[model samples]
Target: MKKLFIILILTGLIYVTYLNKEIFYKYPEAVRYTLKNSNELQRAEFEKVLKYFNKEEDNLKLKCAQVLISNIPLYSYKKEPETFNQVVDSIHALKNKLIIYSDSLKYNKRMLKKVQDLFVDKMNFLCKTNDFFDKEEVRDIDTLSSSFLIENINLAFEAHYKLPKKYRTNFNDFCNYVLPYRNDREPLEFQKRRELYEKYSWVYDSIKIKPLEDIVIQIYDDLKINIDFKKLSNLNLSPTPSQIEKLQYGLCRDVTNYFVLLFRSLGFAAGTDYITTYGNRHSPIGHNWFFIMYDDTFLPIQARSKSLIFSDIEKIFKLTNMPKVYRNVFNKINFKNSSINIDTDVTNMYRPTSTVQIENIFQTSNKEDFKLCVFNKKSNWFEVDKNFKLNNNKVTFNNVGRGIAYAVTNSFLEPINYPFYLDYKGNLMFLKNKNLKEDIPFNITRKYPPIDLPNKWKIDRIKALNNCKLQGSNYLDENSFKDIYTIKNFCSTQKSQFLFKKEEKYRYYRLIAEEVTSYTSYIAEFALINTDLEPIKNVKIDFYGTKESKLKQKSKITDNDPLTFGRFLNMKITFEVENNQNVSGFEIQARNDDNHINIGEEYELKVFDKAWKRVRKEKAKDTVLNYKSLAKDGLYILHNLTKGKEETVFTFDENGNQFWFGVSDVNDLGVGAPMSMGFK
Candidate 1:
């Protein structure tokens, strides 16, 4: 009996080795690494997948299995809690119940709101539960099933071969971009690749006959129309593809993952490109977008319909000044100077980039590496490029995004020097304030970049006020109005100012629209100009012929808030000044984001040395702020201390115009305002 048992154990060992023969024979080192990192069950699962692929004698499928097995050790994933699906199911049930009750007039908006609040509360509680939180992380090597790998590989191969000749990519690109089963930290599920492929088959069929760019547009449009990009209340959940499909909503990252997976399901070589943090200090949140490899180019697609822009070159130029952009890949990239291996740096793919070498003045005894960091919110720095050992006390960083401020720091986060930025020509401009006693007068026109214009839907807003008239009148009657100035050309600016030789002492001024231009011919701020072409002081305005209340309406026209608007819908709007004051000209402003200096808001100015130091604080008494006695050649930030949050770091020219970092050839007044023209 002992001899028989020994023979049987030997036979089972031989069978197990035979099943895992391809991985062990072809990639012995990878097999050893995977087995060393995997537990007993995971080891068995890996063997099962290799055995299944080897038995079928499918060499391509076996190669795919080997790729996944070799790379599985580098990734980790989270398992969804049991209560997660239960909560989602319960929410759906409640929604159905509410809908049925509402059919009989049994539930009102308040009742629905109460239900939503209860659901949010429950999900929030689930997010904080310690038991589920602590057990969330699990290595993919330890949990991925053999069946899941087999189905994912089989479906990926099937969809890949179905692509047209022009769209078909190489095997290496296919393996990295199209064959990966997971793009995010979401859980892996069996048959997900097959399920998604079947669901998106129709999309592939419809666009297969078209060009590569059209294919991307079709996919983007489908996602934009069907899926809603929303942040779920369950903050802890890294939603899987199945969950995203059901919810039809997710954050930018989640939507990006879904978009890539949908393209990969149809055998397109697709992946995600992301910015870990924006380069501008005011833009705190990072962004992610989908991209597909076509003709050896990464074609970018926005996450949602919020922008509706899909051109690759345009998106790249528009999203310039990003600190760093990284592309997701399956195999770990062994960067020469850094330990980070998951994502590859693609910053140069977006814009003109440069290599910078800096002297490490803050070197310490430890001889730790230095990093290039971008400025974020208040006093925080995000590492953009890291792991540069000081070569003779000098470190070189590669592919640096120009037009953005960067601070070099040691491993201890100690700065090597004061903050500095690169110009468009790759010239370093240090953020050092010349501590002079001389007073330098400059105007502050905007708090942020003027790139905030209308999207595709309202693209004609700037040209809408082409024929509108700026008139002056001594009487309140409409017949008494005289045309002070007529806008003969298309309005090409956010704030258009005109001055004419006029000696008339008119008590009233009016902006009248004759032709219907757009959905609404709206003006954000109507400024009555004095003889010197400055905004008239203490001006009062009133509207006539419109039933809309005039109680707070005058402020809408004169408050200097670009977001608030006063429309002239076949109506008369008048700006009344003091009897002693005569209107010489007028300033017309189109609808815009409220980033300009407000009349009543207080502003704080600061300059950066080792840290931000207060320069001055003043209340805005006019549409423009005339700052006095500021240091020369200093990087400054203007903060609206009263209410607003958006602020950009800037420097001024000899002409007292603001120059924003990262934005090229742009000033405080004209960051290419027409919305028709791209960024200047």
Candidate 2:
């Protein structure tokens, strides 16, 4: 009898070992990766908690264990597992309730209530503990608790068990892509974290009874009409669900976070898709939106849309040049043999798009094909996108959807930092220009001719008139100017040219570097001109420098053109004429504040036409004709109704010939008057 009992015991031991092997092999890569990276303490704690469910009598628990073993890898632990002893104990005490809830046939309101009560009690106990409040890791304890762990485990079990047998092979998809609790950053902390979960569960339970397609539209409508949306600048930080309800407004990111959290809490797999920045010149900024799993495919959801599908959202954003769009996930990604540095904190939440370009700043000599890998979320990096041969230090990969990616050579794995977007034609474009600052010339002016000043300039007209008699030594202190009339401060540097106003004139001028520091002021060239801008010749000039400084004067004024100063003051009117069109003449009349013509204020718009002559003009009427009308009549009416500076353009069409031209401000246009023009 003793020999028979020993043989039975050995047979049982071998059977248990075989079952454990099957369980390990059944777990997917994402799950295994998450568990492998977890700290020793967390792994041990997870093992201890799961041990309670490893029983022969509880088939539900065994099945739940299989589902959980695969799903648990998606969770990222924030606290040391040993610190969750009280929470784990609380969950262990309710193992029977958990088993009952896991059983499809046994799961009912009574069993669910018992399970929920146990979870709530555990949460309350943990919240009151000093370890929970004092530890930095406990900041995310709501997500790290054993109760939450079971919630995810239960969700995974339901999704896998209830799924039709024909679709059981897709169990990994349902576990990984459907029933995860997290998408982006962890949901905002609630004072009663368990209560928040309960409310979300309630919402999920209420709507989950409806058809899958209806759920997304219903949730969108509820969020849009119920919440008072506000810009991100108004919120101090991400708000909890309870806070979001009270505040009634949030930035796009905040709203997206809320959307993702609410969906995940209810057993729906959801995440945020975002653009780091829009590289378009028109409106460049970052954007975020929610994407939920529906009908075995991920689709985008918008708060304002009643009928928009995922494809519609894609078209609205013009995803072709979006640069990079990332899908937020919960699990951390591992890069193997990385050659490029990565910000690990953000890598877990996002994955790359289908097409990507990898640019290497460093040159490598080995001629070999580089391996392109996508982050598995559950395991280390694995090659999914096809490998490419390096050409001109860059490799472009097609069909690489959004995720974290790396380029692996035999020596090391290099991260492809820049995310690429597909163009309208479905070609890859990168975010390389996101940080570039474009130089736009708003009111660009044509180059002006350099002005000239008289050579042999003299300083201190007052001192020279007084026959060099010093009234105060302070005037000669080098910090002081003897003649203030000649000095102008247009720029900080004393060497820049200064233009005199139309009426201002002086025969003797001085250019002195302000003596704030020991420096020499060099006079490159100087010239003096009359009212007609004819250069005044042979003026006496002298310069004074400090002991360490000397003025280096050029031998003759290079810019001696008499009209240079006049031309610099003159504004040139340019016409954007096409098809060899021409303007005969134009008349501009100044207007007074009372809308009456200022008689003498009239001028000819003939800067381009040397033989410009004034033409007839009239006060502007309330009715203004379109340019096409004037074009048909071979007459154009330009108006500068405002008393302030105004610019006007005239267009004309004679037969089939079209003429369009613009003039600079008709500074003299009478108030309410139209400046009329005729084409030649």
Candidate 3:
């Protein structure tokens, strides 16, 4: 009788444990969505759970379950919706953390025992929590990995502040305080109070900017910091601190930091500011210098050089007013000595680099390669052959070779540190004319510890994929690497994905597809990306004009949604540009026509480089006009190309990607020169 009783107790414990695994993850999503105002919703959700558990009846449980299932939708209907989304996200993150924790429980005796305790604690308390969404509404990743992930709203800023004092302060001014609690602490408040004592007591009491002394040296003389720039450059290197102190030959950041440390030791507060170093690579290598605040004034301190100096803070801010980006910009703030190599893992920042900028660039002697080009922010030409004269912003090589050409402009010359993003929708949606930062998230599965009772799986949500083709296949699959968005399969479903890169610019592009797919019917959809900034009107586009086939027709990209569709074709589709500056990309969905598309994949053979002549002008390039360019915003009439439809507004897909072709446009940026391609 005793043995039987023990066996039954164990069985009951196993069943309860198996049934409650999903509850832990469901909570995190709710927490994430409510992060902005956790104080209000957190308690409400808890109360709901308390009420749910004590109802004590089958009818109550059924009613509660129904209520839970509807919670996610109800939150959607509420105002201040962004707050709710964060809750769901946080819950998802926690689930991943829990999973990691659980994995260790199996491998390491010490960690395993600790994890088991956590699971029991979590399970016991979670079921009692409120059912704001579904019984399993919050789960995201496994429970173990999110151990260090910060979920609360303050978590973002607080985590940043926790970095060593050096990193905390080295960040841009925007992240100085982390969570932007400075509505009342605007910088203009100081600028406005420059001279009044009685009217602004608080402002008067504030610490004012101070000045720093410049120690200049004669050309013949040298200080400890005055080292030669040449002595400290090469493949992956940095000058030692002893060298910096001994020679006083420091780069922008080194000199600035030396002065900052000096000021701090003198009982005064001083800090260094960084900016980008241009010309070495196409990317900007960040640089910084020191500043001191004293006697209600701020001044720049360049410890090594005497020729250039910043006299005041107000002036300094105006000179370097770069728009704050979401990623770390500090990586560029080094001097001749600071190194930002990926091997060092300084910032863990990885960006796609092109061979186009490789030194000893390939040159072509063949005159057939005549084409236009763009170099950094400048434009010029190169004489590739007797008749083929090409001009571009100054780079190397008076001649060129084929395959792919790499040209490094001033932008890539410097070391640039920024988060990667894909905004290829190309001005077609709310995200149109907008680029959002995208991080490659891990693919997830339902390896959650098996519960005794069977629980059905479901897709919580899904997002679309980008339609642009980057260098190599982007995703793990390699070929159709371009994906717009991703979601974890909480419940596995046997379905294939249609993948492509999102593009805003409209231009000539190609789709290379392999394999075949069979589905219920035959229909197709295509995404039209216009890289221009104007509205698109009626335009006729053709299909399957590959280097083969009967491919020509008409189509439109309506404002409502850019996913335009067409019938089946054995080959490719081609379209004309209208109502935009220029277009770079398009998408196609083929149904019913197995020859046109398969169930799983399609390839877009892209023509990345091309040349153009403004329709308004004869044969001259877009920016080099016959007369002065337009500075003020106005209509740019296309006088030539009388072949296409009479009234079509050609536009590209973004705010910055295209500027006026007119020379004197207010924004100095103009259309780019044509790129070289084809058999020379």
By TM-score, who's the top model here?
1
| Candidate 1's TM-score | 0.74
Query: Candidate 1's residue-wise lDDT over 137-220, tens digit each?
Result: 777877788888887888888887787666668887887888888787766666667777887687557655666667566655
Better of 1 and 2 by TM-score: 1
Worst 10 residues of 2 by lDDT: 444-453
Writing each residue's lDDT as its tens digit, candidate 3 over 1-680 gives 99999999999998877754444333334333322233454435533443344445533332322222222222211121232334334443554475576664453324333433443344334435444223222221111011112111123233333333322332223221232211110111111111211222232123232112422122112333442233322211122223234333434544554444333322233454433332111123345445544444434454444344434433223222121101222222121222321111111111111112122122332223333121121221111112122344222222221111122222222211110111111111111112332232211111111111011011111011112121222122324333232222212121223233444333323332221421111123344444442333344344442322223223322222213223232333333445443333333322211111112232111111112233232432322122222211121123223222111111121231112121112111111211110100
| Alpha-carbon local distance difference test for all models | 0.70, 0.37, 0.27
Looking at model 3, residue 645 earns an lDDT score of: 16
User: lDDT score, residue 58, model 3?
Assistant: 36
Q: Which stretches of candidate 3 lie over 4 Å from their true place?
A: 1-224, 227-236, 276-282, 295-297, 307-317, 325-680
Question: In each prediction, how many residue pairs overlap at the backbone (N, C-alpha, C within less than 3 A)?
Answer: 1, 37, 164
lDDT of 1 at 507: 78
> Residue by residue across 99-205, what tens digits does model 2's lDDT show?
65666646444554444455445545555655654433332322344455555555555543443332232433444444445444444343333444455454445
User: Which of candidates 1 and 3 is the stronger one according to TM-score?
Assistant: 1
